[model samples]
Target: MKRNVILLATAIAAIGSCNEADTSKTPPTNDSSQVKTSTADNKYVNQPLVTHIYTADPSAHVFNGRIYVYPSHDTATGTPENDNGDHFNMMDYHILSMDSVGGKVTDHGVALHIKDIPWAGRQLWAPDAAFANGTYYLYFPVKDKKDVFHIGVATSKTPEGPFKAEKEPIKGSYSIDPCVFKDDNGSYYMYFGGIWGGQLQRWNNNKYDSAAQLRKPAELAILPRVAKLSADMKSFAEPVKEIKIIDSTGKLYKEKDNDKRFFEASWMHKYNGKYYFSYSTGDTHNINYAIGDSPYGPFTYKGLLLAPVEGWTNHHSIIEKDGKWYLFYHDIQLSGKTHLRNVKVTELKYNADGSIQTVHSQK
Candidate 1:
């Protein structure tokens, strides 16, 4: 494992059906299109989908029978890289898609940019997309003028978007990696938060303290957060709640349990009536998942969904297409630099009993 020295870093849904055309409350977007495309180098499976640009933290979804990817657009580092992940320095987002799994992938040009976001500071990180009431919604995290990270939403009439940002960040939302999961009943829930460079630990009781540090077993590790999104999909309907990821024996993991505790990259999927919550173990360099009966979980830790790859950090999304499951994730394969990554996909198999087999993307 190419694990970076474990730094006492800061901390950091559902298979609902698509009601994508339900945009009664959302105003129509009229932004001029600047869509672009790049031919994918897909001579092999499980390879980087594109090399024209660095993409990571893939949030993959199938909309209207087409595969759509919303990922963090990584730029060449202008700042020094550190445990705080400062070099990531992302400024925009590009949407990717294809007709079929092994078919040609197209890079839909900048869907959203830092400059377009009214309250955004810089470093637009991982984003996830959802379809609701006649629109495609892009949920993302960016630092505000105060340099405090907050989640925000952008809208598009189509999946491959020239998405338009709302005037402000989602109120009361802090941290990074916003994953929206829709339940079978048509309700939308959001899961988010990250520590360290993600600035999750700096917030407490819905307030932010620039000097707040992880206080060990007292605060434990920074915990991931969840909230129910209002019908419009732009704000939280309820208060943010912390998720408890405990071991199989029902023991809640402590901060030092590095590999098993939650770090960042929150994802939720529903399978056979059970909810699967997965995440990236940042400092330890692995992707892990836990099983929960509800979207807001006290989930029981399962095992690795993916072992450490060549990259220092990885974020992923899962989709079920044609009855088969696939994992969309990123690693530092194209640039060989942690911040500059390439997104890839691989088969994800579940055991008869419902556990996922660990994937070694490097293999």
Candidate 2:
């Protein structure tokens, strides 16, 4: 955590300010959580940013002059694998950080543990971080006693914690993968939800329908959600709205269009005055984006951001530092097992036309 918090806010406020600008990925397409990743492709080996422990579903941000990463701490619990993602038995979170590009990454020991969260039952998945009112807020996903997933918030004076967990989860948060984006106007909007094991398919008519299956293949694919956050960055400031990702023809992506659909992991960034809503197409193994005029969008699909790396799942975050942009993500490169993963980073670029140049390796 840097003392000059205002500069950090300026960097984020600059996201849509200087600009306008910005997926977990899903499980394998074969309807199984087990994925065999190729290591020989060496070109896709973008090298882990930290190798001391396993981490995934990276949510990266700049705080002061440093970068703080909030990611799901992957653990090998040996819980039998299934479509419900039981194999991903992550129990806690450790914050990873760096001082600069190509700099030393520091693992800021346990920030929040499952044992400290009173409402949590099992699984602490992907998380995102934000700075407001001189306090750093960590937004995360965890399952409650009912086995239903919900998002929760924790707070710390520093970017990395020892964070204090709230006694309850956010009232309107359901499903998983929460991304909190701050607008140039100083408003904070949260984008979240995922299907398959991530459970976006389990909610019906805004209520939990444990038996609900995937939406019809011919109908529009499941959409991620967006809602403004309270000024305190603790609860929803408005009703949650669905975020639609349509194609060039204004046609909404259908369930069968798995290649470009929202699977999990929601992130928003502003560059050159455009809002880029990017996400992972679970099971498809790639990260993609859609561009819109506003934060809440019926965005038109652009194209791939990161190609399928050597894994069954993928999650990432993007930020501009020192006038250059970088993508922070994860893969099973360290253990070669789906449940264990490592965080990695690589330079990301945008074309003259404002479309992101698909990245396959570190620049």
Candidate 3:
């Protein structure tokens, strides 16, 4: 095994200062086996949901009365080429769950590993899960031998699975961070994209082929992309839409400031007839969100929901359970490297007008 150590001092210096006005939040101490609340007396569930292995890019969902978190597994070795993390080499995924809020987490290990997929490359990025027609589906992204990232689907009868991968990736879908969304009417949608000019693709034609070709490079839109999913949740539904982030005044946000705009990890949640579109910013630290009247939206940019953690990258998902909302995100505090990140959860709050309040990291 090859191990590369990125000096903590140099790594911190290169990223410059965080975009937040306050930067005093230090990485959580790895002393305890499980991430618990700050007060030892309160036995409630804490941050850093799991401790046995590194987990990042959390795609959380509620299924069968339990909160299921599908997060990309991270390790200290097997670093892939040309990736951002100094040691980001993930090969498998783990399904974590909690019976109730502030409850213990159970690790359903090895739901899908890279070696099981014939066409998948070693680099397994972010993923999301959904249940329909008595079947559970895991949507994931892996680079192929051609080095192009493609989205693939794995199916299993249960949420915790030894999932079986499709023979090939979802055609026409090529990017990282694949998130599946199921609307109230039983319609499905998948949102995906990445930094450095990655374009979001939508599913259509009972299978993803491209509702429309992505815009030309010069005309490429920086926001995340979305499309309706077919009934089976396997392919795209034609007519893709590029999601634009608009300011309060109803003007489109043009600049790529870390404070606003979608960088990657697009996720959706509906509450009280309003759609909440949340994502990680370009700085790859804070998790920000916006609100819209519909799934595909000219969303109005809301304030930051999460500030930067100890890692150089941040990816997350949002879901409401038992009348409360929670944010699942990843941080490098456990492994102490950008690539080997661990998943964490924090309480989320909303203002009276339906805008989200900024969240701080839970120790």
Candidate 4:
């Protein structure tokens, strides 16, 4: 329950409404007859890719065979002071690639840039990538110089990354939106925090020099801990047992009326054996669900997988592959807030006891 940052800036100022625009309007015109093409020969079909109005909280990962996609890049389009005056000067981090899943696209640009780090020169929020042994880890969030807010780590054997930030932040008391899971017994966990106090730590070793071995803000608030590492993943071997799993209104004792409040991406997964844990709520564009047999849980509320469609605002990632699943989210159009945020994918169902299914708008 420590998940803070004033509840992640009160769930990012209640989910949306930063309002900027008036740079004089006119700049749009790029119509190859209105885009969307896809003649099927692939390589990203007919190609023209340029949808940018400030892509939001994405975070996809497939790794080696490709599928990258890390979002957050809006420096302009109408209001954080006409686009970049504050709102942390518009934020950063953009990386995209595609190969399958509606197939096409061989590559897209901006592998990693926020002026290339240096404390992320201003916001650089919500990134999450992971490949492990062959390397590629990217867990973002920055804004220092006492403006507070931490979370950092970058490496790159190539997910198209020039990466490489060993440690400048990430030692922890409060960080934001990072999610990396590996467990099947192989360990590796790193679920980030939000709302001014956010939490879900563990990473004593999935490497990055173990961020100099953190752990000491009274052992870092303790709510939902894990930490055990050291089999070449790189560090920690002690702090276990903190998994309290939700209950301040974020629901899950069977969830009903306690109705969604967690607010900041969480996303831990397991599947067929159970343990789900998806998050984001009341604000961050509303998405919620829970399940838990144990990756530390008393979890239960499994509902609302996505929402805010025409009003545009939803946060997700859901992946599954061969057997199907998919979800990946983002919306809000008109193409001006840096591009207007677009990135969509659908098809997800479940409910025999697993729960999720009631969210609409694919149009």
Candidate 5:
């Protein structure tokens, strides 16, 4: 929250499966070695699989029967004693993948770096990716030189890629996590928000407008947003829609301290025809989820999917692989500090009623 506060004072800050070996289009990258195949006793592996590097904001996707993860790369702040600062300092993104569920992960190296982005500053925070039109699109948020957070995109011919970033950010888009979901009908929707007062906003033409900014009845801060993406995938096709995680039966979300209202990391996936909207709470330590009938939801907040971990921050994504569901998240266990986090995955269990079971990761 401290880093987020500074981000605000500085001015605004800030998945679906497919068959194996999709042959409809060419892969984004030609690096065949990036695809990892495992012949282990079990198809599954333990949590904290990638230990050598610290990664956060894991966005997991299934492509060509493999799982590709896009995460923010975390490095020491260059200050040893206070390595664990409240602020987030990320500079690059790595695309990690595995052949299947329970397989070994192949670090695809630096897919996108801050130095390469012409408009980005040092703080390259959360990112998410999607495969469409035979291309892999990476959506990320970074603070501009003016210290305002803006969302931008990078593109690669393959999932494991040396992505080429655009010179500018998504028109009219601001704030943090940019999650793009392509529905069954081939329509694309984007969900994004975070940090300072979640006044949800939408992309209009080349700028953004929010209920709070418009003086609408919507809560000015701390609610997530959903909007339809343009056919070309560069901007919003329509006005952005706001999402309220908590119901109106109770007191206003901001008034309820322990409520599971949307805080930051907004993720959406469809299971059994039910749209699951999951996110990390305002506390940053816990992860929670809700379900709706459609993409943009009037969701009913179910409950916590993950409790607090060693790190003060937690962001995640969920996907089904080989008939099993898994939660991709991060923790500070490796560095023994909050700033440097490592990626981890745990089996996600769903009860008979289609509700997600609480995840228990090894400390």
Candidate 6:
């Protein structure tokens, strides 16, 4: 099997400088085998919910008694040939579906492509999907230029589209990694932001022209926030709340001089009555998680979910299937660069106290 060792020095440097305060609750010394066996004796071994390969950063949801996975196409190897100039082409969305996971992904094909969208020219990235009422909403990021990125939404009556893009992009101050969550009280909210120099922004109107008109630029640093949406889920309501979800005082592997917090890939889900926010940190390859009593604020660091294993930086998604949780993430198995990263999946477990057990790559 091929292995990646190019980023060894950089990975060490990043890991070495990571603040222990971020992962102090569950120290690095926790035994991996012990955590796995603590829940049950390999209860996940024969389950049909686990996937073997060819999928990564999976965002899963149940629609019509089937599990549909929407992940970015691993078209580029982060190599020079496929990476014309930038790291990725961002052209297509790969869709896989099964009557149930671990079974067979009966319908596997390119469900949506970049050219399919009206305004999108190129650069499609991570996408998240959810079904509400009678419509399926898919949220994703696309780059219009070198630094100009934006999030766009598409809706369809079925999980696999024929999805039609809105009249314009979902305008925000900064755009990347858009995730949607609906609360128990019947409200919808979206959270997203990554890289440096930008902050998370929430919109009262689900559809807006641009981040500039959505809110002031100064409001971006609030890690994650919640907004109220109209019942149709196509527009937002008045009186939005910009809640601070992540506290990045001394959590990064390297705290560079940047005003906006470096935390990206903000995902919010409520499990057992508490909100759990999972995100990527430590230069985008080191995955970390946090928990909060509410979706909006004061999340406490839970620690590293999975690190760069076999020379790969980890970017991930957490999904629950058949009464079990799985971590869907990406790793550069072919090279140290970002474009070559391939998607991977593994089982996830939670402790009795609601803390997630650390995740590792299966050898």
Cα-based TM-score, every candidate: 0.87, 0.87, 0.80, 0.29, 0.79, 0.69
For residues 318-353, could you state the per-residue lDDT of candidate 6 as single tens digits?
A: 667668676666654423345444444556777898
The better-scoring model by TM-score among 1 and 4 is: 1
Q: In model 6, which range of ten residues has the least summed lDDT? A: 9-18
Where does candidate 4 have its weakest 10-residue lDDT segment? 1-10
Candidate 2 weakest lDDT stretch, 10 residues: 1-10
Task: Kindly list the per-residue Cα lDDT of model 5 for residues 271-351, writing each as its tens digit.
Answer: 899888988765545678887888987777788787665566778898888787878887664565666776777667788
Number of clashing residue pairs in every model? 15, 15, 6, 29, 11, 12
Task: Judge candidate 6 against the unseen true structure and give its global Cα lDDT, from 0 to 1.
Answer: 0.53
lDDT of 1: 0.79
Error (Å) of candidate 1 at residue 103 is 0.7
Clashes of 1: 15
lDDT, residue 52, model 3: 58
- Between candidates 2 and 6, name the one with more favorable TM-score: 2
lDDT of 4: 0.51
lDDT of each: 0.79, 0.79, 0.69, 0.51, 0.69, 0.53
Model 2, position 169: C-alpha lDDT score: 98
| Number of backbone clashes in candidate 4 | 29
Give Cα distance to truth, residue 124, candidate 3, Å: 0.3
Write model 4 residue lDDT over 73-173, tens digit each, in one string: 55442434321124424344556666545554333444566566666545666677777778877777676665455667778888857677654665542
Better of 3 and 5 by TM-score: 3
